[model samples]
Target: MNSLSPDSKEKTQKRVWEYPVPIVKGDNPEQVDAYLTGTIDEPSYYNELCHVLGTAEEGHSVTLHINTPGGIVDTALMVAEAIENSKASVTANIYGTVASAGTVIALACDDLVTSRHVSFMIHNYSGGMQGKGHEMKARQKYTDAHLSSVFNYYYGGFLTEEEMERVIEGSDIWIGAEEVAKRWQDKLKKAEGSDNG
Candidate 1:
């Protein structure tokens, strides 16, 4: 029960990693999916995302489709904060590579929807320091606190306390949707069980 030419062969069988939610197309009068592609480290990028948030009406579901290689860390944090404070229930739909600060901004959404093919990365905060030994040490301490906060922002949803510390100290941890999905599963189960009980 196979359909293949005598000389043809399949290199690899395709597999589905995550279930796709069918976003209703055609005439969608009730919701809007705002597109946000390219790098997130630019001032213009942050302005645009905020513009969208500002223009949105209350109770509207705004989903941000992010496809970027990420940009500036501070910019990403600003965007994330905007999403977190938005009146609209924000959903981040990441279908492409969202690394660096992009991952930070995306995770700020109330709901995160990662495509099966998406890949993400998280690294500790990095910046230059030029001062005396003690001054540099103080800067390092501040950087450490900032790095820990960002790491928690991305992974705090489900990671245990011990695991969180380990991950926060990591240099550059590359991951995919599986990590997010696993965490989301735990949260969903807890919510459902609590509701039933």
Candidate 2:
């Protein structure tokens, strides 16, 4: 039933990998699929995504399925960077409850799609420190400044300046699917235009 000659170019087969599962490395750069489901708190989760995406070929199509309540800001940032740097074209299929640091990973993809009923949330980072009075105060200042930059880097355009300030002030913002689409329309258009060109 095969018509192609032996010298013909081989087509890459798409592979779907469900998250929270062990990563299976693929030999071909053109065939890579990675998924992210559940909390994004673990280093292993970061490693899994990178394992699949690291060798991706330019122009390869990759989709990352995301369903999570979010976790670990540092972990999410690392994952997002990997997604953004991949040579392949990556799309994030987000559904269920995406909250906290999960938004970072979802937004890093070259394209993003969300389910109709999906809920999105973002909030300020939280941490506690125990040390000498001066040390604790210094740590607090450093953490606040660092995390504020991270939030602005990812959510700057998607959220208004006022809303972003509130989030930095410890407010939790919840957004519906329609708003998500609306907020992201400009970015989507730009991506589309670039692809076409």
Candidate with top lDDT is 2
RMSD list, candidates in order: 12.0, 6.9
RMSD in angstroms between candidate 2 and the native structure over all alpha carbons: 6.9
Which candidate number has the best TM-score? 2
Tell me the tens digit of each residue's lDDT in model 2 across 1-197.
Answer: 77765445233222223347334336764655566777887776578567556667777877777888888888888888888788888887789888888888888887878789989898998657799999999999888899888888788678889999999888999988889888778656655787799
Q: Mind giving the per-residue lDDT tens digits that candidate 1 earns over 1-197? A: 88766445332212111112112212554366655566665565457557666666678777878877776787877777778777788888887687777777776777788789887765655558799999999988887887787777566655556666666677566667877666656755655687799
All models: lDDT? 0.67, 0.77
lDDT of 2 at 138: 95
User: Residue 138 error for model 1, in Å?
Assistant: 2.6
Model 2 bad stretches (over 4 Å): 1-31, 188-197
Pairs that collide in candidate 1 are 41-72
Worst 10 residues of 2 by lDDT: 9-18
Query: Could you tell me every candidate's TM-score relative to the true structure?
Result: 0.69, 0.79
Residue 39 deviation, candidate 1, in Å? Answer: 2.6
What TM-score would candidate 1 get against the native?
Answer: 0.69
